[model samples]
Target: PPARGPLGGWRKVPRYNALCTLYHESAQQLKHLQLQLAAKEATVRELRGSLARQQQQQQVGVGEAGAEPARSLVESLLEQLGQARERLRDSERLSALRVEALSQEVQKLNQQLEEKNAEIEKMINQPPYEKEREILRLQKSLAEREKAQATSDVLCRSLTDETHQLQRKLASTAEMCQHLAKCLEEKQRKEKGNSDDQIATERSNQVFLQLLCFVHVLLAPEAFDSRDTSSRFRVHTGNQNHMHIQTKVEHLRGNSPGQPGARRTASQSEQTSPPADNGNSGSEGRAQGELRCPHCMRFFSDELSDEFLKHVTECCQ
Candidate 1:
């Protein structure tokens, strides 16, 4: 076979096409990754808000439970006060009955005194019975009158003491009730404030999440155009498919005149192509395998050990 010119590399189209296909597929994968990253960021934002809300709800539950003791105490106190009120009412009723009974007793005593006096007068006016019998009856009636008077004094003192005690008890109960009512009002106010704060906090968190979601949705995915074009560049050379493309180019450049720039560009393009002429395998050749990770500058390790190969395969995958 004769030496071919530089432009005679179309025979290597299969290999060049393979490389172009690989680059396009890798680019599409990168685009997919960018989209996934955006989606993940949005999800992370929502998770953060959900975490905050869950914490707040947990705290609220704890606070409500904590408040129960004080509320229960208040309710118990109110119950006791109710019982006390019932007792006081009963006491007042009993006192009123005692006072009425005392009045009736006094009236009966007055009537008894009058009757005794009338009986004595009748005995004097008639003067028809034995004097000894009349004197005995008068003596017994006087003793009974003295006992009735003492009983009336005792009843009056007892009633007066009970009335004073009831007044003091009523005043103390009223004060206690007022204190409890005030405490309850204050507790309710504090709870209201806390609830308002929690609600505001939740609303703010919701707004934040909404903003994050909106940004994620509205922001453009990474532009494929911005990526490096080196991968897309298909450099045909003489070695690939043994097409002898460079030979053809050289023959053309030599036979044709006034095409030095095309010859030089073709030459440079061949020099820069991957898999430089070397005995080493294309992948093992550092000149061809020298890929700089766009994200990091670390050189890929040479080791084909299980771990290294696994990591590289996984990263590419």
Candidate 2:
């Protein structure tokens, strides 16, 4: 009678049991969606890892390793890598869209529920016989909702575990990639593969290291002092490892976190963790790890891209 069909009708139709069942069913659907989200996230992570490995392999080439060729190849590969990264960005956009849609669904359901409650007020005033029927219908629907909710809870729990595990895997893979790159560089050097070429490769590696550091700083400014200015000394030394990170996170600088500015000494700044703790340490760790971009005077990860984007958007607006 309330006209919203199943949602509103379930309130006055004397099918309490059915209403319970429907609620449970909706809950189940919510859970299924959560699981789907988790699965998609996992897939994205796998894609990132696979792409990284492929890029590395390409950088190394088919065989007979010399550093200059490798370096030039790496530069070339970087351009291709950028395209892959753009693809990943598109995937991220899709995930964001899904999140938005799901949020809208939740909002709509809440509104529908409020409307049902209003209708229930009218039902409560009905004659006893009809009221009893209405109550029973609601009871049934409620039961269904409960069951659905339970299923959803189960799915969400599974997804939480999977995401945590996947995050760990991502961290490990980044570390491994860093190590592999280093070993390859050293191996090429040891073979005396080509000094001129080796020198060029070192230049390329240095440039990569600089970019890595820049990105890290943008992502995890708190992990390293943004005030340190001895760029020459800071790049090679691990002394600033204990300093607190600062940020005006430089995402669009085409700049790495390892800018000459961060190398400056910040004797006045406290070396404490961020008190306004945002849950970014995992990403921070990825940025900080010496292995991934060890020569980094500062590092930023793509994770900070969101925060940086938000900041810039606001500033421009």
Candidate 3:
């Protein structure tokens, strides 16, 4: 009945239609796998481009302190990429095995249909299937590349966010430092100003005290007596005779040192002319702390005697 040997195998082949169904399912799975691979490759390419741009920006943006974290992130990304590539390689190996198995089945089918060799040869000669497999392979590779690129892109974005946050923090810190420096400078300036003012005030006080000492030295009764050797001066007798005493003091100043004895004798003669009662009263009045300024023709009561002395010194000068 059925042809023997090689042709007889076709009778068993129909009974094993499930094998063809298995082959079709495998082809369908391979197509899906290839599509998945293509998508992964596209994702990888996009990610790679983004990662490169981000790396350039990162180099410009970060300093040594910031570089530490960015380097860590990049290291982690690289590790993940390495793992992904390993998985992709494993998938590729598995896909190659599956394709090899499908090719063996095709060869077996060709052997079983020896009488249909010409038709099979024509089918094999058609480029469409080979082209489809090539396209699917290319898509799978592209998908793997794309998957890797996407991961890199995500890592880049995260790093960029971190960089921006750090930059903002650094800027704020710098502003605070500037503010503190300004405050310190202002405080120092105020302290310096206060010190300068204090020094100036002390200098003025010292000058004033020295001036007071000089004035005291100038106004001393001893100083006047030492300078006017021609005059043997005594206190005025009374407030009533202030004008007469002032006139005599002026005449004494005008006289030469040679007339000291004659001036003293004249002063004693005038003093004796006063009545005894008047002289006693004048003496009592002199005891009461009264002062007269010969140069200014002014008299001062006891309360104003200190000021009167200062004024007399100035007038004499």
Give the top-scoring candidate (lDDT): 3
Off by over 4 Å in 3: 1-10, 14-16, 58-81, 113-317
Tens-digit per-residue lDDT, 1-317, candidate 3: 22344224355566346556766676676677667666756766666666676677778995333322365665665676667667666766876787677678767775656655545555556689786998899999999999999998998888677556544544543454345445434544544555534433232222222223333333444433423654323323355334543333332232222335535533543464323233345644564344445444355654564576577667656
Model 2: lDDT of residue 61:
87
lDDT of 2 by residue, 31-137 (tens): 66566556655765666666576678888884335542345655565566566556656655665666566566656665766678677766665689986898899
Provide backbone clash counts, one per model: 9, 51, 23
lDDT of model 2, residue 23: 53
Which residue pairs does candidate 1 place in steric collision?
A: 4-247, 4-248, 5-247, 5-248, 5-249, 6-245, 6-248, 6-249, 7-249
- Tell me the alpha-carbon RMSD of every candidate: 64.3, 44.0, 44.1
lDDT of each: 0.44, 0.47, 0.51
lDDT per residue as tens, model 1, 1-317:
22223334234445545555655565565556556555655655565565566668788884333322244654565565556556555655665565565556556655655555566555556655677777889999999999999998998888677556544544443454345445434544544555534433232222222222222222212212224354322223236622433332332223112334544544553454344334334433443333222212223432332443344334333
What clash count does candidate 3 reach?
23
Task: Give the better candidate number (2 or 3) by lDDT.
Answer: 3
* Shift of residue 294 alpha carbon in model 1, Å: 86
Q: Candidate 1 vs candidate 2: which has greater lDDT? A: 2
**TM-score for all predictions?**
0.21, 0.24, 0.24
